[model samples]
Target: MPKANSALSRRAFLTSSAAGLAAFSSIIAFRANAQAAAGELLMVPAAPNPHGAIERLFLLHGDPLAGPIRKIVTESGNPVPAPTMESGARRVLRLMHFNDMHNHITDMHDKRGDTHRMSQIVRRMQETRAAAAENEVVLLLGGGDDHTGSVFDELLGWEPEEFVADAGYRVNSAAGVDVAVLGNHEFDRGAEMLRLGIEKDARFPLLSANVHSSAHIARDRDYTSAAVAEVKGMRIGFIGLTTQVDTRIGQPDDPDMGVASPVEAVRNVLPALSQVCDVVVILSHCGYGTGQSRSGKAGADRMIGEGDFDIAAAAGPLTDKPVVLIGGHSHTRLNAEGLNPDNVIDGVLMTQAEANGKYLGEITMSLAADQGRTGWFTHVGLHPIKSRDDRVAADDPKFDTFEKEDDYDAAFEEAHVAPLRLALQSKLAEAIGTVTAGDAVSTATVEAERYVGENALLNFMNDALVKRSAGFANGTVDLALFNATAILSGVAQGPLSFGDWYDVMPYADQVHIATMTGAQIHDMLQSNAKRIVRPEEADALDFSGFISRGFLHFSDGLRYRLVLGDAVADARAEDITLHGQPLDSMSERQFRVAFNSYVRLGGFSEAWNGKAIGAGVPGQIQGMDLRGLEYEESGLVYRNEIIAQIRQDGGISADAATLDGRLTVA
Candidate 1:
């Protein structure tokens, strides 16, 4: 699709690719032309043997077996039925894949009293495993957002290059992760630390074929790059890829990593692994466009269809893969297109559980061994193992009791290798301040944006910014907008402690200043409303507006009244006001805006066309990273207060879950 690779010539497209050195091994290279103008580069064994000797296999960089594929047929007699398996024999291949858990293992207390999002994730993960653990085979793979100082392998002072294995979480899993690739956050701890973890800490294999330690892979490479594991005797290969954006955002000392073309990574590895394995599946950490990102389709369905590579979007990619594609990054749910047939991407299933371990994705794939290499992947967002809220009771012991009764986390309290966390608690993880609306509330849990009923958080952030710049020439902006997407949970209106702020914001984003004209500002506000109050799907997380919050999560101070109760094209606004005062339409003015560093630029699926003005005060105050705190107001508490008030007024109300085209104006 990108100008057919020279390797895939017309001659190569029409006839059989010689088995080369593989036929002797029972493997054959079927240079089959995909229905698309491009090709579906599939490799399989020419025949199935009791010993299973097949040459010419293909393997991706990160995934292990690239499958949870149902055995279309068991290893049968010699003649492998014409490269394709029959449909009647197909069964579902149930598999569970998730990423970026970042080793978070415990409950976080909030306005709801106790939020056990992490434990909930683990419970569901275990549940899925228990239900299907004995199936032909199941894979638990990660997309690599394993942050530092988390549950397993806590990196305090010693660099990550020195360790391996997440010993703590190991006991909990019946079988730990089968494989994993890298993520940008993985670089935060640096490559060495990651390498050490993979080598020592992990019980399973780690694959990353696309990423080479140096020019050309040679024998004896120390880096644990890729793997090919047998699932019920099925040779399944996996590969890994990571975001290149890491280059523009981080410091030089970060893990200096690189990835080969993901499409090419498949081409190069699949052939090699397919020779021995029955199925070649790619576990991509690359963003999805499927060729669709490039406006082409190569996999099985429309989103992923048939292609040179049968890949899955390991991280959130616009395009999907024909084979198993597990998504990560952007932390959005799997409601996109290919996952969740209830909405349907050709029923091309995939899943994206909300971030912070809120949910897990369980998929079942069906493949035919007699079918040679044909297959299908389905996505499912498994019900997260959860707590009994005021309305419900916990069903399992795991959720019934949070082991948070202890003062310190058990994961860290008894760590043997090093005591770096407690050492840096005061400096890196110290609590030096508090937040509140009127009186002391949470000294440990500070609210970011109050998506909850009354938002001391949103109000505090906006009011803080106005107060911080009270005497400035440009004066404080009308409001400090925040993306509700960033709010973790609510803090009971009161004193906010340092840990509370970290749990709320959790990034290193600094406050920013912008010089947007009144018109641009208005455009942003309008889009802002469309993002928050806009009608959307049921029971899903809110979209980050494909952009970050500017005025606080749906908490825009009205510069002008917004009126919308129709389709996209039928929206308008009027009745302008600033500081509770009337305003004219033709007025042109520059507003000094308080913003997050990440949002200043377009963020994951979120972009605002606002011109930046200048840099403002740069401080994390009390050991907080400037970037970590989103929707900050220089005042006391912070929150997305607008949503709360509007909800109370009985209008502009929408679920904080999946942002879609559903909200109506009152």
Candidate 2:
């Protein structure tokens, strides 16, 4: 893991020589200074390319003459050839696909950084486009999830009123993306923000065949179901398909939007697209799940909607032209080392790069009308942006390397992303409150204790919700409850900043107060036991157990004993109490409970092998009436509520996490 910019001070950074160049390119200056000050990874270029624009630009490559490009073979046992103009082929195309970028604009710090750098991706794509031959054309396609999963999502607020800038999408536009599919996370901010990105930031068209929005944004004008790109007199048609699972989650902004079946959506559009196009490409955000998982295990099915495998099988017979599917959602690394044969579903050529811009998926193929519009997949593989450690480990000199941030991308970063970076950095670094709680809870501790049982940080989060929501509640709120998975990252001890807490809970979930009787409360708690696994058993659990997101943590004043059985069906919640009183004693008494929006709108249910094993919160809780003031308002988001509580309390108390057998798992 990389160190946070703990030693780099903003004041010193502002005074440095690099900072003096702020008027020119603040991002480049900041990157240089930050690297020097914090000892971050310094990218080393192998050697400058002598061929210039004639050769492909790669951050990692083998012997330039013998084998500069990594090779993948077909079932016939022949090495995939490098890009070259084949006289036999009628049309030559280089399709570059990447998915699940999740807004990691700058270089990442963790192992993900070792592979993905947006700057590196941009440079490679630019070079690919520039080097295209007169007869050959290159197209870069995004496979969805172009938003969320970073501090960028936080700094760039979601709603129209809170928007800071379309920093993420603006960078993509500069990258020259031809078309992108709609990902589930795109709806994380709201439909309006999605519309705003397409309207203001996107230079390319966004396609989604299944997603229909009743929002004010025009249908074909703002976003379309399909788009065609005419390259070198070749008509290449693209149809986008989004997973229907998330659209049903009922986001506040996307209330009017609906998601239909991906297979059905693709079927309807193929007929119209095939009429005028030479080839059809399915820009899919549904998933790449079929036959085997990434781990090489059998039946590696995606937990979500119908996967690309199913889509390809259903849509293959509908189109006479060569069909290609570029996918996202599952974040499957289709060609990690090279092209995996499993990706070829039916006759449709398929590819998906792993999430977070770690690797760029490249498929070099040609369409020839010699034998009825056949598509030849010449080459398929990934271009990895290697880290310093990766370069050192390989220790090979024959491969020429490229800097992670070239001048072209650096300029773009400076113009588009630097200001937001600076603003977010300063704001995150400011100490909003102190972590005066029990010996300053470390992030490591939170990670260790989050799944096993009750912990201080968990108590602190739920307590914050309870305390804040109690203020707005007309009567006393009994307690707060949230899923364990809600906490993405842990907070550091001592002086706390918004960044610290932001890392812990980044999702823009609203706080809600639900009216429920004691019986209903017990049912929710009982369902929780089915998902709870001991820390020791966590790693060994099957896919169904891992996918289950129902394990819960209660706020202070509530206690429950989770008893494990031989199987999940036998598991149950017992000895439940609120304010030291057994909950069963007051079964008829109504209780006001505070929780996040995910709980109120229950969709955490999961299935494996077509059967529900995890017990999610029942959609219809008995005697339930969700009535409250300002509970569902946009301003009452969980993060804001916690921030308000922290500010009011000055700091968390040392006893906030004091576990007095509040929650016991056996």
Best-matching candidate per lDDT: 2
TM-score of each: 0.49, 0.76
Backbone clashes, candidate 2:
2
lDDT of 2 at 444: 65
Could you give the C-alpha RMSD of every candidate to the true structure, in order shown? 14.6, 15.7
Candidate 1 lDDT, 1-666, residue by residue in tens: 012224434453223223312232353223433111111222222211111112222222122223321122112212222232122333234556666565554333333344443444444444554554221345666665655323233332234443434432332231345566665555443355445544444444444554544232211132333454443333455555554432113222332335445545544444434444444444545443332122111111111112222233221132122344455544545553334443233222334443445555666565544554334434455545343233234675454443232322233234431243343245333333332233212322223112211244443444445554554444555545554445444444434344544455544334445555556555554554443223332123222222222223422344444464464333444565555554345258655566654454333223332222101101211111123222323321122222223223332112222122112234
Q: Rate the local accuracy (lDDT) of all candidates.
A: 0.38, 0.61
Lowest summed lDDT window (length 10), candidate 2: 56-65
Q: Can you write out model 2's per-residue Cα lDDT over 494-515, one digit (the tens) per residue?
A: 7777766777776657766667
Report the number of clashing residue pairs per model: 121, 2
